[model samples]
Structures are given as C-alpha cells and as structure tokens.
Target: MFDGFTPEHLALLRGAGVPAAWPRGGVLMRQGEPADRAVLIETGVVKIVSESANGYVSLLALRGVHDLIGEFGCLDDTVRSASVVAMRPVHGFVIAAPRFCALMEENGPLALAILRSVINRLRHADDQRAALGSSTAVVRVAQVLLELSERHGTPAPRWAPKARHLKLTQQELASAAGTSRESVVRTLRELHQRELVETARGAIVVLDPEGLEWWEPEGD
Candidate 1:
C-alpha cells in the first residue's frame, strides 16, 4: 500500500500517471493479459479473481484505497496473474510499467515501501491458504468477514450505532471463502438467526463484529 508515501513521493507518482475511472463491475485487468500498466487505487474497492481451465472463478483478495494492482507483472515482466474487477465505482491513477519501474529506481524510499508491501502480501496469502485448508467452513467465513472489515469497512460515527455495512454479494463471499454458495447461505442463516448479521439485497450488515469474529460451530 502507498499509505506511508510522503508528499514528494505521491507527487512523483501522480506526475508520471494518468487518472482513470471504472464503474462498478467493470474489469480493470484481465488474467493472463499483458500487464503494461499498474493502477494505484485512490477510491473504492476491487476484487482479485482467477479462473481455472474449467472456467471456474475464484476470488483471491479485496483491495481498497492506496493498494497497487498489477504490480507483480511489472516486477517480474510477466502477464497479469489475476483479473481485477471494480466492486464499486473506482477512481485511480494508471502508471505505465516502464514509468513505474523508473520511479522505483529514482526513489529509494518508495522502492523499499513497495518491497515491504509485496512481502506482506505473500505472507498473508500463505496464512490464508493454511486457514482454508485447516479451518471449518464457518471459521473460514468468519475470517473472511474479519479481513473485509479490516481492509474496507468504514467505521460508524461515535454517536451512531455500532454496525458495519459490507457491500458484497453472497456469491462473492462464497468465492472469497473458498466454499460453495450453499455453504455460505447456511452460515449466513445461522449468523442472521443469532442476530450477529443482517443480509439485504446485495450487502451484509454486521451488528456484532466481536461475536462474528469469535463464532465457532456448536459442539466445538
């Protein structure tokens, strides 16, 4: 992420890039395509997705403001590893691969920050893979919710009730959790019955974040 960037560093990047926008559901980058540029998200969220030979799609991660997309390709000179789609209307800066590489070479601090971010993401991916393999479906769901909240949630005002609204469809949640839609539906029903979450047309409202985070299957 570029949250740690100083004003000068930000200015350098902005000067080298062009601003772009995408409506919700628009594809920003396609898997296996030439990664000629990288996007630095300034607003809204995007989902990283990958498709298999069988045409099954899997959601890898949710990225929000300040996150860099398609940088892996630029770093390694490879095609895009996954597709990125806008989860909401998005505004960002698009920097050509060559320009981005040049910026890193010209700025030591910016390069170091990018390296740290890459390492952190690799570590987080490893942890998530392990969790998916070892944890129950409910636990995985809870973990995903916690991650979404930490990454994209907007905290309610101090005077307002403590609730967080996440704009994600059940199918998207299922893909992120690495489970089936039926499994996600069952888990949501349980959470709804417990008054921990409320589901609307295409969103989820967390009424008790603590309870959701600590939830475990009965008899566990």
Candidate 2:
C-alpha cells in the first residue's frame, strides 16, 4: 500500500496522523471497540486476533512496518472486528477515522491501493483456511515460519552467521498456524534436530532456509 503512494500522497497520509508508540504486549486496538482511528505502523510488529464466544482466540494476521491497521473498520463504519496487539515495541501514527476516510475520498490512487490491499488480505484469508483444512501440522508450521522469514526477517548477527531471525513467540506461531503450542514445540524440535532452525526465548533463527523449504516429516 505504501509502495503505491506517490511521495506527496505519502506525506499527506503521514501528516494526517499523530505520532504514537506502544511497548511490547500493548493493545493498540480491541475487538468490538468503536472504530475511531487507523494506525500506520512505522516500526515493529503487531498481531491481529479475534476471540470467539467460547474464549478461543484466533490469530488472524501479523502487521509490521508500513502496514495500516483498523482501516477495514474505518472503511465500513463498523466496530473493530479484531484486536491489534504489539508483538514488540512499536512506533507509529494514528489517523482519526474521519481524516483517513476523507483522504481516501480525495485521493483516487491511494483509495485504489487500499482496496487492492483489502482484496489481497481477503485472498490470503481464503488460502489460509484452505491450508488449515487440507495441510498437515508440519506443513502449516513450515509455511508460517517461511512467511515470517520472508515478510519480517532480519539477518542474524555476526555470532550467527548465515542465519535469519524471526521475532515471534511459539504461542503466536501456533496461533497463526492453527495448531496447538505442543505441536509447534514438537515440530520445532524436529527442525532444530535437523539444523534447519534455532529457537530462543522469543525468536526463531533460520539456519537453513533452503533446507526448511524442502523439509518434510521423517515418515512422510
């Protein structure tokens, strides 16, 4: 979405918002809350989740730098459908709903970009649902890791040469993969044993991305 904006348009969007920051574990927005504003994430990651009536929380997606959240609510004039929690310390800007909607109305290209982004998200949701129904736990976990690496990974430090780090927790990964935490633990243990990844307290380092791509369960 940001890539589609012209410099002037980007400046306008940024200028409309006030600067804000959130510590790790902060709730930027909550489900069922009034849709009053949209957040433009300038740094760090956040998780979007929805809680069911039975108290089950489902991870819907992850948003990082340059991502705009809460726009769906703003667009539809409805309450927030999910919660946005900071996965790490986050810095961003908050644009009030009216301003955001006005900007969209006045800017054709920007509106189109946001529309495309929404369509892409819907498509991704559909694909995720299909995978959850058809793919094995191993496949789902691997896919989630690969997505994190591709979308948000940073190269590992000098001490971990040729590796890449993903800043996400095991529980979060399990939620995204639609599996149990124990299952993710077992799968990650297998991955570690195969030297495909290294896990720490709140991060996973990919030691062999290519290998992970080709990895399958031993008996598969």
Which lDDT values do the candidates have, in the order given?
0.83, 0.86
lDDT of 1 by residue, 1-220 (tens): 3345566766777787899999999999999999899898889999899999999888888999878888889878899879999989999999999999998998898888878788888888898899788988877887797678667766654312667777888888899988888988888898888777788788777777887887776667
TM-score of each predicted structure versus truth: 0.91, 0.91
Question: For candidate 2, lDDT tens digit of each residue in 183-208?
Answer: 89999999999988899889888887
**Model 2 residue 5 lDDT score:** 44
**Superposition TM-score, candidate 2 onto the true structure:** 0.91
Whole-structure CA lDDT of model 2: 0.86
Stretches off by above 4 angstroms in model 1 are 1-8, 155-160
lDDT of 2 at 123: 79
lDDT of 1 at 191: 85
Q: Please list all clashing residue pairs in model 1, or write none if there are none.
A: none
Model 1, 80: alpha-carbon shift in Å? 1.4
- In model 2, which range of ten residues has the least summed lDDT? 1-10
Error at 27, model 1, angstroms: 1.5
> Candidate 2 — which pairs collide?
none
lDDT of 2 at 99: 96
